[model samples]
Target: MRFVFGKQDLADSARRAEHCFLLTNGLGGFCSQTLTGGAARNDHALLMACTRAPNVRWNIVHRVEEELTRNGAATHLSTQTFAKGSPEEGWQNLCFAQVDGLPRWVYQWQGVQVEKELAMDWEQNTVALRYQLENPGDTPCTLTVTPWLQFVPKGKNLRKTQTFTLRGNRVTAAGLDLTVRTNGQLTPCPLGWQTLYYPCDAPDGRRKTGLTAACLQVVCTVAPGSRQTLDLVFTLEKTAPPAARVLRQADRRCRLWERQGGFRATAARQLAQAGAAFIARRDSTGGKTILAGYPFFEDWGRDTMIALPGCTLSTGRYAEAKSILETFLQYEQDGLMPNLFPEGKTAPMYNTVDAALLFIRDVWLYARYTGDLDFVRRAWPVMERIVAAYRSGTRFGIHMEPDGLIAAGQGLDQVTWMDVRIGEILPTPRHGKPVEINAYWYNALRMLAELAATLELDGRDYAALADRVRESFRAAFWREEAGCLRDVISGTGQDEQIRCNQIWAVAQPFPLLDPGQEARVVATVQRELYTPVGLRTLAPGDPAFHPVYGGPQKERDLAYHQGTVWPFPLGAFYLAYLKVNGHSAAARRQVAHWLTALEPALREGCVGQLPEIYDGENPTASRGCFAQAWSVGELLRVYEALERSVTDFFDHK
Candidate 1:
């Protein structure tokens, strides 16, 4: 899908920043900047390289500034925000901005129009930006391209230890090597600590300073009435800059992403390509990993399992999915999956309750889609250990209760995916038998039972355990007065707050709720939690509901699960909607309309991707990560679901 922007869209800083574009290498490195070709965050870079595959990342080049000189008048084609305001009004010269395969920006001034395209190699830590000048007015112009270098670790500010030395076209700063190769005259420029501001980081209560140490200017003269193109290459490696042919090849690599996804619908196709950005290959281990989000967040186990189906299965990347599962299987501790793979040399943290269960469900779905029985048999041993560990009680006091439902968490541990713990306060303290965990628990048991039977193994025990869990789950979580399942049944009390978590009861492949109960749960969720983009975390009627998600760190964390709208949960809502409505034509039509409402977001925010969240009250303004994994994954999953029904309709006819 094409995301087109005009002059008016560029003039507004907030609007321009909201519409960001991302170009990623399969090794967890990426290039991101505003549509106006400006650095919006410290993480917005021309070459954010993965020193270690998918984890140890460093922001190499923050941005590239383009200056065009017409006669004596010079126009800066780059925009930046200082401690004051953006003095460089280059955005006014922007004629159009779009990203079909690569990010392309068109700038017109006097009669000179220059189209700048940014693309990266699919597997290399290299970024290439080509500027082709169309000077129809017959005016000769000198175009200078200078790349701003921010040689520091990702998500960190450049400190006093920062050093930059320029030799010819090569610049080395703090052990990070960057080579600037261009057709134009390269002049080494040693700049020290150029302070850049990040308006996006203020709400999250982070240091907003982006420090750049140096820039290398590539000066070239463009002849009038003729198309003159200049190629600028930035790489972490010592190799020379690639030729213009590699630029076209990079475009092909991007297009191949969409063709491989095999989705005919516009949103699905766009999201499928966007989903490809998160599936990075491990450089050290040679396995696939899923990045949680852009600009921040590394590979996390929970996000990986939650995002696996949409990012891989829906996009028809089954081998990558298998690799991802195997990668996490190697990191499994006790019966729990690692919560996160810490950057650098830190050990993986295993503190989550749902990732392992979600992993089982993902494995079952993977086999069902690919019909890979052998793979299932191979993964069966790991699944068996995960189930046994959970049943006997693993980390964080996770074990099956006498009531047959799983109980977990104690002290300061906030598990079960509502896991936002700020200091001693847990925003959504679901520290006991969370409704969704039990739903996944039941689903996992049922899947294991079925898989065992299919493989001629003992299935009766698992089947009995699943049946017992379902009965206990209904009794413990079903709130008769509320007309919906309770959010969590804990030692403290049953949280009766209407939450999106209960949707899982009817949404899972092996549903636990009865027909009437499922309909009630779906209707309740639709009435209270549904939004055009996603489902609200909490109902508006709740006293704890925080409509806006902003302010300091504590405020943002408190509001995170209070009332923020998460697009991922909408996937479950859609499944529940379809299940209750019996996959009817009317339900499909309504689901299609809801899906259509999210289409404009493809062009509006984080171009070709969806945001992580939106304000509970005003959802039109997207907050949090501009490009989220589960956000894109869940949307793709729902789109695939609707597409399957359409296919079935034709087949029955």
Candidate 2:
């Protein structure tokens, strides 16, 4: 999808800043900034290079400062927000912005039209900026581009002055080397530090201002009524490839990805392409992994399992999906998957209870989608270990109770996805049997039974265990008063909170709830937590519900899962909604209508990508990570399901 914004769209700096664009290199490195060509967040960079695959990133090139001079008249074509006073306001000259294969910006001022396009090399830590300058007037125009350098690690602000060693066109600082290449004339004039402000991060109490310096400059001149093209490439490699070649390679890869799913809808096709941003290489495992979110999150176990089906399987990336599953399986310990691999660390953290169960479900899905029984046979031992570990006992007191319900979490360890801790305070403490955890547990058992049966293994044990889990789950968590399942049930008491967790009971491959109960659960969620963009974590009227998700770290973490709206759950909600309604024409039409409400969201936060979350109360503004993997994955799954439903409906006719 070619997303184009006009002058009117770029008129408001704040709105334009919200409409950002992101480009990833499948190595966890990315280039992102606002459509106005300014850095709104400290993480926004021209080259946020991943020195190590999937993590250990650094901000090599912050941004480029562009100036167009026509007949001694200078027009600033770059925008930067300063910590003090007003912004640079170079957005005034930005006439057009387009996000196609590459992000392009066109600036027209005084008969000089300069179109800038940015691209990143595949699997490499390199970024290239190409400029096409046109001078229609009788005077020659000069375009000067200067790159601001930041040698700090990703998300770290440059607090101290850096000593740089410039040898030829290469600048070395902070134990990192950056080679600057340009087709235009290069000048080694170092522009000193400037404090840039990040308005979007002010509420988080994070470092909102960072210092950056211009280490190199490029100058290109176009004659009267003539056109000239200039290329500025930055890399850590020994030599920089041609900017045009990098752009072509990037564009070709994008086209190949766009053709993957053959999705009928334009939104689905766009989402299919956007989902590729999260699939990154894992050097530790020497396999593929799905990143949880861009600019903040890394490859997480639960998130990868939740996102694999849509981002990979649905997109016809079966090999990568299998590789991702294997990557997590290799890190499994005592039937537990690693919650996350810490940045710049080889040791994986095994703290999540749901990731293992979800891993089993993903394995089942991978087999179901690709019919790869050989792969499943190879993974059978790990799957059996996971089930056995959970059934007997595992870390964090995770074990199946006498009644066949999965119990997890001990002490202050936040195990589930709502895992947020503020000092010693656990805001959304769901240590006991979380509703979704049991649902995933039940589904895992049933999937293991089905896979075992398919592989000619004795499956009666799993089937009987699944039966017990279903019966015990209904008896323990079902709440006739709320017409839905409880959030979490513990020895203390049953936490009767109207949360989105119940949606998974019906949304999973093997639902534990009856049809009538599932319909009521969907209806209750629709009435209480449903929104156009996502589902709220907690329902309104609850004292603990936080409508707005903002403030300092403590306040934000307190409100993180209290009532934040997460888009990933909406995928499950829609699927369950269709399932309970029997996938009728009316139901399909309603689901399509509900999904249509999200089309504007695609253009809201990250141009063509879905955001991690929105505010619970007024969800017009997107919060948290701008580009989320599960958010796009789930929605794409729903879109694909809807398309298949329509196809099957017509095929029968």
Candidate 3:
């Protein structure tokens, strides 16, 4: 399912007046927002929001403009309904607005002349929103505009009921086990919400449900000219029959404080409705493939592989994962998982280094997570074919190394755009012996061998091959000159300047480096490349460093990897650090600190949910795309990894 909104910025003038929706394929509704001339171009605030609530169909109504009606006395014109249309498209205009690129709505309400424009930004793991309300009606409008984020799981769109009890002025789902005490206060809930973390927080946050439906009470009030906001946060659980029931029960709270029960219930409906939305999306794919995120990213081998463990695995979506594998395999023409399916076609791109190898990792894990060997056998041929193609050479020059290593691409393969500063792809030796390609190669072979034997297939030579690569990888990539793994070797020479590429060596599917080397590399990255937000693509000592960011072209290229930081890799580095060092209390604390810094990003109106890239420079500006798929996926994965460690410790002890 998808959340639609407008604008990529926080305070865009157009965003201050628009409407949109987070659409499931079945819910890509359209709307119109009046643009403020000059505000349209420079203020290209694209709307972005993210949700892991299973099976949701979100269609939001954003506040964009004002509607006027003659007063009963026929004396003056004042605001009436904020919504601009009848139920049908031809009959009326859907009061839709694009706050930048985000979708929001000019919601209809029975009140004086009161209106609000809502937007969201990513604060690291949490979601944050900005609300603006205006009252232009006489006698003031008690504009009770409730935010409706919908998540549907089945059938057609059916409206649900909602209720809201009150304590003071603060408003919340009256039945939630959360405490609600409103005193004109605008603050986040202390419900241990850090679970919104990209790295799933294992049993850590999942276990933090509020007291019960009756645990707390609160409300919010917006007087004329005085727009008030309440940062309403809810920790959504996945769809279990039990969870669906609880959410539906919670959704029954219709009015809280001055707002009606329907408003609060409308908000909660988005959470519970996710399951139906999921089903609808699955159906919309016409029984073909389930795209990961809607209205944006389609199912790419890379994005799907990276997101599977967290996006699907964490939620017990094994069937979906297997199907995704089948879908990619069905379309495996030149071998590489298509960089992305072209907007409306089945054609794919084979220019990436990480996707196919990652698929091997996913299949292995799927087998392990479910202990399904038959699934492995079913997938074995697909894997073998892919491996064969990679060993032979395909689109990006990917092939097996004579040294038993894996390699892809050529001069400046830019195999990854992590930090392509100056529009220059780092000479990452697409030919032979890149660290991650081999790590993945090693892992894929080893895992495949183990699976092969489990299914009584020819697994003999594979183990020996994996061992050789694993041993030689440690020999080749380790650079005594720089404590980190060599970023690349010039096919014939050593070009081992420490770079972010080495970070992958630590986190990739295979552990080619011995534990000691892994630890040392982790330490070096933690010290040299790691930042509070993420790791810089290049070390400061490198001439390639370019933290000062600028506009597109000259500026965008300069800031890319030349010196900027990637949040996704940061998640990997953090987990790798935990994995190598073991999860000490201090380590977990560090994890919390590094990730929590992104809290501000969740504040509102950033694309999708998170920023795609960060500045390489010191106050390290977040550069690149906002709401990147992998950025969110990896972060969530890291959180889960850390939490699982703690859980395992407790379980074993």
Candidate 4:
């Protein structure tokens, strides 16, 4: 899981793809087929036209939709529904990637030495790659691959002709079949191998092919040990106007590794810089986490805090983390910082127990790592407010019980990103003292104790509070029979059914349980809930554990979070086990072996670029959308921790 300075240099990737001009960062966007509108260039990519369901349903809703764009005019695409799963759901290896440093689980490079792997790096205006591909066969093979490009809005002036430095010939374009069959099956058709073809200066580059946005495919025929360079440029002009979400802005660079798994085209350095600069640039006084996308969320404490270790600590972006803390505390209600601010809202949502607490832990950790207490002092008040809010009663019934355990509850929107229920929280009734939230809460208070002592604040209360919550959590939520913490507390009732989310209590920074309890959780989940694609949401014995991740409308919707296995959660659970168990020589080797499980999906896109979830049945197939932010985020975190463990060994030596 540890990543080294990959020898595969971005600037030197023998096989590579580059855009002529930078594509805008698509965070939040409004889109028509080709053109996109967003808060800024930071909106999500509009590179590819999105086709979700089968088109033949002709509900006008399911009629496959695509938007065409040019500076002058844009085209709308109408295509049939999703690539169906007639035989079964799977992704085909469309091309061999020239990129490197992908998860070791994917892409078993036959001839490429581990040292000769691909490398990726990005600059403000450019992304570079250098990777080695080894062909075992004597015959030269044509490597056909397509980089997945996502397009976001440039403006209504969607159509424009642009050129770039080109090294390879265009591959033939083929219609992407996306039809879904009965039983929630998808893509039964045999994929047509795309013929190589190039685009002419039609108003929009892809207008001739009737594509609104998506990556283009290309091919390279190389002899064994041969390497080729990929280069291209993009031209964009303002068309009619930007769609609603797009804000006027300068060219933006997006750092991709914050999540580490996705349609990554390299954004780590710029993100680090922007985040570092945010504090100096801010008109405000408080610390805040960097906003992933802009305008909607003023600061999402969870994402901000989670990103702290990598975005700030690892990348040398300390000042911004300090500034982020300064900005985040202003929204402290009672004790909690705001989770998210909807558009046009001065107030923010306090829908989470973990985020504010996590902020405190992040701030404390930041101070420790950077040797900065000025940062600690700046963050003290808001952190205090967050601590105080958890103790005092707030909305969603957040409070400290007499038993000393922290308790919060019952709001539907309260679930973390794995949330599936729309309108209201799904009535599946997961509530009261969710395992992970409290673990974060416990960790935060303990961290606050260190911060307080370091800064001469009242250190006693933090330590005392931490102990009390620990004692209370152990007494109330632990499921002696299952040997793991219950998922939640429903009024006086504790949910004893095992759930993946419960792993947090045992696996997080401050697990509530002792080593024995921790071991039980690790063993139980590994035996019952673990799957190749991801961890199951619930153990199969639970009535609610839906084995099939897909079905007709309602079934699919219900299954979204129910029993569907999510790969990201497994990352945390794995690390928690490792941390609790201590690394055995045997464990490190197993870590290497287990990681290979993720490889099949990465190169082939079988579950496609790491899907958000998977079914709980045999095959444990990937489900949900192709890319989910946290799904990748957790993987990155897992790998990061793993890599750190290895580096720690070297450092000690």
Put the candidates in lDDT order, highest first. 2, 1, 3, 4
- Comparing 2 and 3 on lDDT, the stronger one: 2
Task: Tell me the lDDT of candidate 2.
Answer: 0.87
Q: What would the per-residue lDDT of candidate 4 be over residues 1-653, giving only the tens digit for each residue?
A: 12212223112211111101112122221111101111112211223221211000100000112222223332221111111222100001112122222211112223322111111111111111122344454555433332322222222212223111112222122222211111111111222221111121121122222212222333334465554432222112112122111211221122233332221212222223223221212223322344432111223556666655545555545565566666666666767666664433245677766777777777766776578887678778788777777787666777877766667755565545444565663735555666677778887887788677888778788888888888888887777886677777666442876778777776566556778887888888887788766788778887777877554445676776667787767766767667666766566567656766766544322112345566776643344433333444445445545545633311110
Give the alpha carbon lDDT tens digit for every residue of 1-653 in model 2. Answer: 88888868878767866778999998999999888887888999989999888988999888888888877778788888898876777788888889875789988899688888889998989998899989999988899888888888998877556777777888999998899888899887855777898877777787788888876678998999999999989999878999999999999888888878889888888899999999999998899999999788998888998999899988989999999998987888999999889765457789999999999988988887789999999999999999999999899989989999988988888899989987789888888888999999988888888889999999899989999999999998899988999999976542888999889988886778788898999999999999999999999879989998888888788888888999999999998888888888899889988888777898887888999988989899888999999999999888888887633211110
Looking at candidate 1, what is the lDDT of residue 551?
84
Give candidate 4 regions above 4 Å deviation: 1-301, 307-327, 344-347, 411-418, 422-425, 491-494, 551-554, 604-609, 618-621, 646-653
Once model 2 is optimally superposed onto the true structure by TM-score, how far is the C-alpha of residue 513 displaced, in angstroms? 1.7
How many residue pairs clash in model 3?
Answer: 118
lDDT of 1 by residue, 466-501 (tens): 989989998888877777999988766538789999
- Between 1 and 2, whose TM-score is larger? 2
Most accurate candidate by lDDT: 2
Question: Can you write out model 3's per-residue Cα lDDT over 10-79, one digit (the tens) per residue?
Answer: 1333243221123232222111122221111111112111222222222221211122222322111111
lDDT of each: 0.84, 0.87, 0.47, 0.45
